[model samples]
Target: MDELDLKYALEAILFASGESVALQALARAIEKTPSETRELLRELMEDYDRGMRGLRIMQMENRYQMLTRNEYFPYIRNIVKATPASSLSQAALETLSIVAYRQPVTRADIEYIRGVQSSSSLDLLVDRGFVRIAGKLDAPGRPVTYETTPEFLKLMDITSISEMPKFEEFSGGIQLRLEEQPEENGQQ
Candidate 1:
């Protein structure tokens, strides 16, 4: 709406994009010409620089992105970097099995399948660098879906997820036993 509003909006958009956005595309999104958008970006860059902010905007070739400053990388790395988990607990293993097999599945679905709350197990899988939040479902509430990361593939010594044993192998045995039960409700 106003120039101040536009500036704030651009800041939020750049942060959310998490990747470079072309100047032309950003202008179109904000209903401004390329030149106008470029000027606004410069002003924003200067503002961040003047304040010595830990996060700054960078122009990567023809696009722009907001990222943590190089000076702070050491701290960020200290916080973010970690050794991958060497051993998985039983719950974590179970959670990983579900994610690997029913990939892009949600926390709710995982809990339902396992018949218990599994927040901690899921947390361990994520912190251990095995599973990741793939994306959100389009349905209401936008539940986060999960999938195995490349690290998991490499650790499991597999080239692709499809190479894993069939999901039916994990589920079919249960179904068979249930179906094998004799009918008694109507007395045959």
Candidate 2:
């Protein structure tokens, strides 16, 4: 297909899916090599960004998704009569941070780090699609492990976990000291 046709085909796929489209899938659909498809996606993304358009394309890892720019959310919400998105609570945010950084982590590990029970916060994160059960740990009893989802990346406006700010960059004021807890046998 011609360049313009290829671009329009990609745009149509993105708009119709309304979800992240894998690079490979896009390439297959457009009958182009992955590199060529990536270049095309880059061009499309730049076109959207350079223009005063309400829509934007987000690249998450090897996937691309078309979405409305955050700046237009207020107007869209007004028109759609959608309730304002709720902000995460401090506990939930902390829980999410822990999961994002230390996944696949278990509930015990999270509670140990926060020095507080995090069941409710974890549940809320799961319910909101920000966190998911990656698998069960290999330790005794096989505790379920959690990890951040693509939705988490989307909320953070990041393409991948590697794009997250280095922990040391923001760790100066934070200190975590693990205290020994007595076991059921009363041994610490």
Worst-scoring 10-residue span by lDDT in model 2: 179-188
Cα-lDDT of candidate 1: 0.78
Which residue pairs collide, candidate 1? none
lDDT for residue 173 in candidate 1, whole number 0-100: 54
TM for every model, in the order presented, reads 0.47, 0.86
Measured by TM-score, how close is model 2 to the native structure?
0.86
What are the per-residue Cα lDDT tens digits for candidate 2 across 1-188?
79988987999999999999999999999999999999999999999999668999999778899999988889999889888789999999999988887888899999999999999999999999999999999999999999888788799898887788765556546553545421121010
Task: List ranges where model 1 is wrong by over 4 Å.
Answer: 1-85, 171-188
- Report residue 48 deviation for candidate 1 (angstroms): 49
How many angstroms is residue 37 displaced in model 2 relative to the true structure, after the best TM-score fit?
1.6
For model 1, how does the per-residue alpha-carbon lDDT over 1-188 read when each residue is reduced to its tens digit? 98877877788889999876888888988899889888888899889988789988876434777877767777877989844437888888989888877778899999998999999999988987789999999999999999887557555644456666665555555655656442322110
